[model samples]
Target: MEFFVEQNSVVRKIWGKSDTVLFIFAGASAEFALNKAVDWLYFTGKLPSDPLGRLFSTVSYARKIVFSSKDDANKAIDTMRKIHATVEENRGAVIPDWAYRDVLFMLIHYSIASYELLEKKLSDAEKEEVYNVFYRVGRRMGLKDLPISYTEWLPVRETHLQENLQKSHYTSDLFKQYKKHLGPIRFKVLIESQKLVVPSIVKKLLYFGVFSLLTPVIPMYKISRLIKLDWVLKSILLPSDYKAQINELDVHSD
Candidate 1:
């Protein structure tokens, strides 16, 4: 509870507002509605406005849509329709929920593509194509310009970590949940990121006595990913723009 509060509270303090909320729940819930809630609040008038906030808010709204059921999906679609209408009428956007929904869809699709690759699930040509999409999105999201060759992005022959995973184990449960739901390709991404680390065999052996298992990591990953990366991307927007985008998406009559 404390970790959850701290993690969310930090975003609140960073952005400012108790009215600021994200409705992500675990294992089969009405998360699309939560996405809608984010869409509403963000579109309406209560969240940050910047590349980092846009990325975080986008993922926060997207996470649920990725995990939702058909019924939940329909519910989200209905809610999205209303949100779209509201935002269109508002003339302002920050953390634009529409842009978020787009990015969120790409992330889920990429996770699936990653899974197929990890299990040797895709043929060579298919794999190459899937990887291309990954690079395209990475480029779009401002994750450094995508490489000319998609295959190049895979865990290089060199032993390295996924930048997303190599971090402290602060939000272990959230990270664990992400790993569990991420399936294979996404899991492999985690395996290679800063959010997770491959400890030396000797270290693993030494820790085995105390922990008994490889630490499943993701929450910690989020802890790090949330750090503002605008400086690196040199993203060219102001916080107010993102806040305006979110406000424009707001639709809940409340």
Candidate 2:
């Protein structure tokens, strides 16, 4: 009955709530677009073609790993590796190890960022715990040169931000696809949400302004969550088609 993430773990608190998970992807969507290796994502045609579906699919695997037993979580990780291996086989080139690390780093970064944005600040120990979970995932996936601790990871994460991201044609096209899929209103929300969680480098690279529109709205949104009226707001802010999937993001609450 041992879970991949312990029952009382902060990782569960971060990923269990729908709002935090949404913001995690909202931030990740920006970084994913700006990644130097984004063409690898485009190779499958899935990310650009149905970005929201891709988000949910990725979230599904993440939650499976976070919530299941250790054996099941390891199996899910193996499946993900095999899927990428097949993509590499088809494309006839290996995806760079750094690209894999970038993704793992994104999960670690955004998990802390999104949760702190929605809830209170995490202590140093809690932040280290977050890093440890994903560090294990990275090791399982055979990524090399990952920083051994969250403190060590900070500079490495910064280095990756500097060396591994650029505004390519893929960046613009992916943002366009996001806007197309989310529409004007939701896309604006997504951008603002990304502002609240993404790193300074991401903000600078994307030319985001100093302020987010959501800065003032977050307190009000927190109030709405306390009263159980958050879904009403979510309905208005999110597309109707994904409403069910969005609701399902609140796994630990049940």
Candidate 3:
């Protein structure tokens, strides 16, 4: 529509006149790449919850390698480590290799979309308006319940994730760290007299033909507590406040 074109043009203009150095260093689609990653992982039933901070933190993982920036690279690694731990704890369902590749593809696609937001016209508000459209793109692609992530406005390929995986100890260390945090008794069943097929009712009597009624809510509460806690903590730790990350840079890259 004409409205979109005009809006996009304005947004691109604003970005063009704003800080160029930060734009390039930040990887134009960095936000998009990371958000898409989280979205896909969540949809595939791989990740438990959606937290804006978690998405942002993961991007730092991708930015450092692609952009050749120490700050971005270190930040990205920190995010990867955090997620690796969570994945191990909740990986009750084994995800296929294709799932990881699919996540990577989402990252790449969003990265490009995000970079487009940085052209010469978008204002801070306009950038938000434009990038939100990408979330729609995810919904159309069968990810029905997508989160409203602003990754479409972020730069992409700013850091290389593949390079970070080169660290031999990264995955194991992350898993160990998160597991320790979780403690050994991550999943414990409260049972009076359990039966096969995970029976809803207990098999034995408590006080000679007497028993306490069990509520499903009790176990669901336990699971929710674990998932929600990690989601909140990760979101807080990732994406380091954007205002602090911003600094002066050259008008253009050669």
Best by lDDT: 2
Per-model RMSD to reference:
18.7, 0.9, 18.7
TM-score of each: 0.27, 0.98, 0.28
Q: Which order, best to worst by lDDT? A: 2, 1, 3
Stretches off by above 4 angstroms in model 1 are: 1-120, 155-164, 173-254
In candidate 3, where is summed lDDT lowest over 10 consecutive residues?
193-202
Q: Please report, in order, the local distance difference test score of every candidate based on alpha carbons.
A: 0.33, 0.92, 0.33
Give per-residue lDDT, candidate 3, residue 46. 24
RMSD score of candidate 1 (Å): 18.7
Q: Write one digit per residue (lDDT tens) for candidate 2, span 34-62.
A: 99999998999999999888877887788
Please say which candidate is ahead in TM-score: 2 or 3.
Answer: 2
How well does model 3 score by local distance difference test?
0.33
Worst 10 residues of 1 by lDDT: 21-30
Better of 2 and 3 by lDDT: 2
lDDT of 1: 0.33
